[model samples]
Target: MNREILVENLIEFLPILYKKFFKGLDVCEITKQQFELLYCVGQWDEKPMTYYCSKMLVSKSNLSIIADRLIEEGFLERNTLPEDRRVILLRLSEKGRGFLCDQTNKFKKEIINKLEKFDENDIKRLNEIMQEAREIVTKLD
Candidate 1:
């Protein structure tokens, strides 16, 4: 198969795959964008609003609105830096962590159940192909 065609296929299907994977599974009722924010914020102990803006490739104004909504939804909390009160940091609340963990477990169970139908050789081949794809993707990063 042509590499360009393969890349185009991935580009077209990746969003579909993501939507299928995550749809109807957000027990906390957060939007996909909000869930992404929660996931990024939860990856670290805490991060400044600006840091998230850059990491998420969103503007400060946009991030502020998303952050505000997550805060209202009890998925995130904002705090001021002790040394610099002007700097605001975002962190996942207890509810946020619980939701993330729950979603992760759900995904794990679903994936495992789906994979169990395949034989060991098929699983190994899938893993090898996925690893190759991962390496290609990492080059873009």
Candidate 2:
């Protein structure tokens, strides 16, 4: 494959590798696809169930199944808006909030500390790579 394609592939694969290795996480728990869906949904500040399927690029049935598991696990909740009963809102539960807070902090700090073992130039190069990816993605949007 070409350099650009290899870069794209690595960009997508690295997070999965890190999650598996460092987090001691198994993709089969949520399944990798569901995990991606949940991550995208969780990133949203305002979540409407109606829009989640389209936004996450998940099928209606699959979204419903994921939602059902999330609800059952007490990681997500469905609520009716007072202004409109037809409008359903999705928000993280207390368990979800605490879990994410702890996990994200631990993950981020671990990455930082691990990468810190490298010298200044290596760190600078890492930051440059991240910035380049961000710029490319932002420009595409």
Top-scoring candidate (TM-score): 1
- Tens-digit lDDT track for model 2 on 1-141? 698998899899989757744665443344555555456557884477768877777777788788788778787788887888877677777776665566567667767776767899988997898899889878753
Q: Which candidate is the best by lDDT?
A: 1
Off by over 4 Å in 1: 1-7
Write candidate 1's Cα lDDT for 1-141 as tens digits. 698998899899889867755555554587777877888997865888899887789999999999999999898999999999988999999999999888778878877876688899998997998899899888864
Model 1 clash pairs? none
Worst 10 residues of 1 by lDDT: 19-28
Cα error, candidate 2, residue 103 (Å): 1.3
TM-score of each model, paired residue for residue: 0.76, 0.66
